[model samples]
Target: MESDLSTSDYLDQIERLPTHEREGQLFWKLRIRETRSQLRHLFANSRLRTSLVISLSIVFWIGLFVLFYLGFDFVVGQVGLPGATYHAQTVQFVFTLFFMSLQIMLIFSSGIILYGGLYASNETNHLLTLPIRDSRIVLYRFQESLFFSSWGFFLLASPMLIAYGIVVSAPWYYYAYLPGLMISFAYIPCTIGAIICLILISRVPHLRRIVVGIIALLIVVVAYTSIWRTLDIKDADLLGAAWFKQTFRRFEFTREEWLPSTWLSNGLLEAAREETFDPGDLPWFESGKYLIVLLSNAMFFHVILLWVGGLLYRSSYYGLNSRQARQTHLRMAWIDRITEKLLWLLPRETQLLIIKDFRMFRRDPVQWSQFLIFFGLLMLYFANIDRFRQHRQDINVLAWVNIVSFLNLAVVGLILSTFTTRFIYPLISLEGRRFWILGRLPIERDAILWGKFLFAASGSWLPCAILVVSSDIMLRVSIQVIVIHQFICLMLCIGLSGMAVGLGAIMPDFREQSPSKIAAGFGGTLNLVLSAIFILLTVLLTALPCHFYFMANESKLQTQMIPAGNLLLWLSLGLIGVVLLTALVTIVPLMGGFRAFRKLEV
Candidate 1:
């Protein structure tokens, strides 16, 4: 009886074993190997991997970095000793504050972008269904998030850090402080964890729908405030070591004055203050500040990693699975039904495309929010142009016309580019697996392309045309010049719209992660081309007219044929420049894009 019971227990143990530990171990192992192999291939394909260019570039950058580092180091080293000639402590304080502010901003913005857009998206669902372990999936996604966030931080702080390092003559070990490498990777996982927690909690019956956007906005606001406060150096000059000594006697705030970053800044100062590289005098090593920072960083890094590996990973996976589980079936009456039906007037295909674009945008608020904020700031900036024209008397008629014209040009560029990535670029890519259906459909590709073109162009220009008319009315320019400028703006708007759609169609990346991401890869270049062309045309239009007007102003030959001809020449040149630039803008991109789209497989 005892032997039979033991055998049954052993059999149950074998039955309950993990799949990898059972008969499928080899297959599971092979699957992991295959997954890794595919990922490696994708990585290799994505990277440019230019050995010579990369090496040369790195060398050039590092040379510049070292040069800047040495210069700063020498200056800061001179200031470290007692009775130093430089009373630049306030300057150092200001710089430190500035650096911290920028750092905070980068970290916070990165947090919002990663948390709401990347980490909480449908991609997580796709990843979860794969055969890979959840931990590996989490690690890979986090690494990708870190890669993007770290790059941003590097770009923001590298120049400043280099300048400071040079001024302070920082030690060889100080080279490890490469802007954001240590803290970014550490804090990023914390942000990821926080985002995961928010996602999980927000999945309650009432919170899921708007929670992501609200949390993202809150994080962005907090980030902005933190960055602003860090750099708010009000009356910094008056608060010196002597003031600190007295203030400390009366208050208990002295201890917290030396924050971790301050310690780092001061430690660098101490190291640089030394005349020679004496091991004994080197404050970084002697004061053990570097060790403390290293320990703190190490602790932060491990804690974040463990949490990400365990709790965050599980939460992210579970939260993503259940995020929108209970879709609210809002009670709709007859009017709501009629309105919804009316909204569906476009053909099913067009409606689907538009709905998809809007839904994706609405779901991911970070990108659209950026556009809104930018528009708000620009409108606020140019709302009152009285300051620009305040002290400048004798402003010509063309100057007012030019100001209105330039503003129109700017409005067109800004609004159109916002949609370049969102609506234009993704028009083709959004077709995804269904792209093969085009070959089977009776419709020509041009018909579909034209539909997208009309969609993007009409949508962008509606606002642009309204802006032109409003600006004309506000500035009270001559109707003749306004009409001509309006015509010019119309042509340019058409041209820019074509360029946006065309470039986006041609360089359409089917596997785009987000519209903003697509914009970075291709839409930005297209906008740059459009902006440059418009700027050049604007310069010629304004400059040539101003020259002719000034020439006319100086001369008494208002009725002379030569002066009339000269005025005609400037206007003709302006019109011709606008015409040619607009032509290049439309024709060049459309043809190239048509060919590119025709050749595309999917």
Candidate 2:
């Protein structure tokens, strides 16, 4: 620890400190102590019973694990697929890829979060005025950040491991599972923390977002390729002997070269086959590949921690302390000025809301990241649709595709509603004491709702509709299907946007205006569930017509169930859909918003 501290001072050039620098150092130490005190107070607070909630949550999660374990155990026992001759090598390969990919993603996500502006705020500015060693403060905060990030990683990985163990039904010595899993999970927080630290230390800070994005994309691709045999395009050309060699290629790779996922998988397999793996036959198993992988991962994390202690602490501290360059000009071009003038047609209040939503969106990196995620999902769906095409015989694949496409659009609409809500949901709440100021004004409640709804519709639902349309066209979907799908999707967007407005109005909570809290709150959950139910109902209605169309086509138009009556019934369903959509988009939300405003505290 002393050597590390000395090395850090030398590397950071902190020893040649001026008089003011020494004073600033003392101030920073005090700030660190104060921040630690705040953390302690938060933990001790009666209102924040985090431990109790966490314990209960863990117990509930364990119950889920038990259920998964029992189910997998039954399936494996009944199928007997784990038998020596039963080689699910492809599945194993895919599983290994997915496992390693998840580990990478978790690490990457943690890195971004740790590097992000979690502590780079006015609060941190004040904290920098204390007396502690800069390295000590950084270490403490890094550990705190890890504590927050690690729970999510554990939740994601543990159930899958438990399910696998149940399926493998390995013997008693498999109790070595706890240590192995722990070692595997260590990289997530460690690597993330290290990456974040390094990025901070490096003055080229703008590259951080790009680096995080690349890591995320790489992980996504790795996972996808691992899970889908079709994605393993290179392997497709391999012949019988080549395929066998590919399966046993682990022997050719060194322990360092192998991914933690690969090692964990190999370890699990070896442990499962301890009863059968003969050293003379399979030297790979006897080579202790798994243990080596685990150790390497653990050691790598420690190296990262050391780097954080040395380079990161001072760099991050300075970065947090510095003032960012501010825009000097409030000037606009002729086109921009014209656009603003056109936008000014809306009432000043409504325009304000629109501007606010746009500003909030522009300020958030997380919101922008959703575009990447949606793009990925779109690609995956396109791939699956192509796969489905290989199986489409006599079916008007267009009709079915429309159903699936609109269903996908429906999900997009719902997410858009949710995403936009994160910004606008807190708008009324952010008004705080100014609520009375608004209430005292001549503005009607309905007008306020209308203003909010219009802003949201323009920003959220409208853009989602455009994106879906663009994607549909890009896929070269049939024109007729696109027209219908677009119509249905537009209707869905209206409904979801309206739902969001209503929910925000109804469940207004100024005190809990944080986006994350809003997402987790009962209001948000309720809106999500309702949106899902509506989407489900729409799917059922649309699917019935699709099913009838497919069945009629397949049967050579002989005894069609979709006759005149059924056709009328379908049209009637469409009419009902319109009415329900109107209700969802306009009436329910209006009423909800009105009620919420009436109950809203001034």
Candidate 3:
């Protein structure tokens, strides 16, 4: 009997040992192989070699740096009066506040990313089944999340930081310090984001709806406060002016002074100033105090992550996984009934397909929530047009209005491109292994393709049109300009939607389950690059004629080179060219996509 007990104990001990001890090494090796495979595949394509891709990426980044530098130089030249050196401090403070707000945004965005798929990935589930320690898995995921979230911030900040250095003419050491500051600054947000995600996943698995509601309320509150503070218009009398003065003078306390972003900004600004001004009394590295603060805080947060990860990672992961088992049925029967009633005019298949897409979109909290946050913020900004008009009365109101109206077209185009790439581009790819079901259906490939295009175009058009028309109305532009701008926006929407759907179909990644992962692939990159190029060309074509007309009216030399009649003819030709370009961009990709889909054996 004692020997039997010992044998059973030995067996249990063996079972407790890790199933795949070399899994960590295996994971990295697979990653390397996948990267190499992608590179080989990219180079295999005749149109896009590895060298060409690298060259273009480098050129694009350099162009961005140069453009931002020039813009900064122009702004500083305009605003940097000799006696206004005190304004430098104000600039630093404002930038500090901006970075702090961005960090807060990052925290929420990271939590969403974690909840969306990172923690609940297939690999993570597999890992949990092994005998490996849970802390290691948490650590690995945290590292990956940090890298993914921080790299974009680093790329964006690089140009702006370099531009600041050039503007200040800082010394070499200041340039050296800039990268360290950015790195440490990035780490703070990443750590905070991880902690927030961990807490939410562990403590409140069903918190998404509550959090989204809170965010919506906060957005409304912010919009209301901004309008209240800025809309202090009154009668042109003594009481009115006094009321405005008093409102403007009301003091408020803020926590910006203690924020890490403030520390980073102060450190960088001080270092730059010292390099330029030669403040001899201060010791070397005295300006390094804020840098020290940033680094120390980053390190402290990282240590906290390790501690929490070691303690709660296993239990939290179990909680998270268990919560996934409790499925909630969506009460979308009303939606189906309404759709059936409303779409009686259309064919059954088309109506069913549309309804399916709508239900899929509505069911995915991650997808629709992101959509709400992005467009909601835009709507909030648009809602404050009255304040913008009130504050900018010192300028030529008509010209300002016209300029804003023209710029609004570009902004709307960009927003549409983003929406298409994020949502529309992943539609076909997201069908996954179930695509065979679609193939067996009686629906034609062209019908499916056109449905996606039409849906995407119509979905994007309403918001774009509303924002554009509202801005135009606020600007009080002429009826002719409003009609022209609205037409341009419509064309942009159609073209962007077509490009996104076609490119998505051509390079559908059926293997990846996550939409974000699919969108991060090569096809998505190409879609974005093409969309940007198209937007640029469209804007240039439309804006040039407007510029000529505006110049002809504003300047006295208009009659010499071109008469108003000739200018109108030129403008008409330009509009025609724009229409042709938009049509071509919209049609070619869709045709290619249809052919690609038809050729697929599945």
**Model 1: which ten-residue window has the lowest total lDDT?**
247-256
Who wins the TM-score comparison? 3
Worst 10 residues of 3 by lDDT: 246-255
lDDT of each: 0.53, 0.57, 0.70
lDDT of 2 by residue, 1-602 (tens): 99999899786765554454565476568668976975675477623334544554566567768876776566555545454443345435544665655665456445544443234434444445754454444454455445444554566557756676656765555556545645555554456555555555455455545654675577457536543543232533333455445544643332234466666666655655435464474423432556666877776765666565556556755664464865676764464454357577778666554555555655565555555565565555455444444444445665655566656666665566556455555555555435776687676766677776776666554556666766566445666546655666666666666777776776665654245445444455556556655665665665566445444544556455457557557756874775576566567766968887876766
Residue by residue across 390-492, what tens digits does model 1's lDDT show?
A: 3234536445545545555556555555556444665566554467866686665655665566556555555556655556554555566566656766665
lDDT of 3 at 105: 60
Deviation from native of the Cα of residue 255 in model 1, angstroms: 17
Greater-TM-score candidate between 1 and 3:
3
Report clash pairs, candidate 3: none
The local lDDT score (0 to 100) that residue 77 gets in candidate 1 is 65
lDDT ranking, best first: 3, 2, 1
lDDT of 2 at 33: 95
| TM-scores for the candidates | 0.58, 0.66, 0.84
lDDT of 2 at 289: 59
The number of the candidate with the highest lDDT is 3
- Where is the poorest 10-residue window by lDDT in model 2? 230-239
Candidate 3, residues 334-406, lDDT tens digits: the string is 8777866776877777777777887787766666666676666666666666555665664466566667777
